[model samples]
Target: MRSAIWVGAILATLAIASMFLLDPSLWFAPERNTLIVQTFVAAVVAAQLTLVTAMPLAMIISSLRNRTKTPLPTYIVTVCECGAVFKSKPMFCSRCGRRLQEPQTKQAV
Candidate 1:
């Protein structure tokens, strides 16, 4: 997404720069110069519109991707003899610092 913006900006810069570099006669010919400037302005406007539109489109796509993902399993609860309960079956009790026994868990639905 960031790369797309950079590419668009670079291309627009190149287009504007090339308009001056490619034609030295544009300075004398006011009508043709106006036309060229207008064309480049239109191109820049179109590119900006595309980027603005794409931001929301990309966000929607990423949100849909996240929505479709599977959820992780819930943690099992572990109880220490020191009367401390911990989730996810820790190696030692937090309060008493004693080693925990095997966690007794129900089946995940």
Candidate 2:
């Protein structure tokens, strides 16, 4: 998709530049019918190339707008008797080699 945009941009730039750089007299010196046909073809090509280059930009913007961010998982902290805090709940305390206890809840009075 990106490559297509670059190619279209380069082609459009070249077409526009050629239209400006080429001498008008040269086209007029040729047959009148040929001049008109060539001019029309050049205009159409430039317009189409411009449209092609714009499509990728629109697609990228639309995709970005539709994007959603996912939240990361939350880890439970387990504190050991030795005062070592672990980010995740562990079966046993690392330092004291003791079983970790779950938090105690108060009974309703």
Candidate 3:
């Protein structure tokens, strides 16, 4: 949450800076309100849309992996289930469905 706030703040500040640079005369003009307002509005809307889109994707990935029982999360849980009988630590584990052990896992080569 703190990182999200920091990210939003940084992006908003950059957008504001860019907007000001794009319209230097706006800083002194009475009608400059429109540019400032639009910059903030667009920044907030874009940040919110990004968070909304990302949150559901993370939840869905977790839910789908839990349902699959692919030992993907198992490795996360620190239980290497490369086989049915025993659980061992993976030798060269990269969690994107590649098993780099002696006997290859049937899940993905």
> Of the candidates numbered 2 and 3, which has the greater TM-score value?
3
For candidate 2, the 10 contiguous residues with the lowest summed lDDT are 100-109
Question: For model 3, how does the per-residue alpha-carbon lDDT over 1-109 read when each residue is reduced to its tens digit?
Answer: 5555566777878987887788787689987777667766777677777888889999999998889774453222232344322244455444444454653333321
The estimated TM-scores of all candidates read 0.47, 0.33, 0.47
In model 2, how many backbone clashes occur?
A: 0
Model 3 accuracy (lDDT, Cα): 0.63
Q: What's the best-to-worst order under TM-score?
A: 3, 1, 2
lDDT of 1: 0.71
How good is model 3 by TM-score?
0.47
Report residue 10 deviation for candidate 3 (angstroms).
2.4
Please report how far candidate 1 places residue 72 from its true position, in Å. Answer: 3.4
- Worst 10-residue stretch by lDDT in candidate 3? 76-85
Q: What does candidate 2 score in Cα RMSD to the true structure?
A: 12.5
Off by over 4 Å in 3: 1-6, 64-109
Question: What is each predicted model's overall lDDT from 0 to 1?
Answer: 0.71, 0.63, 0.63
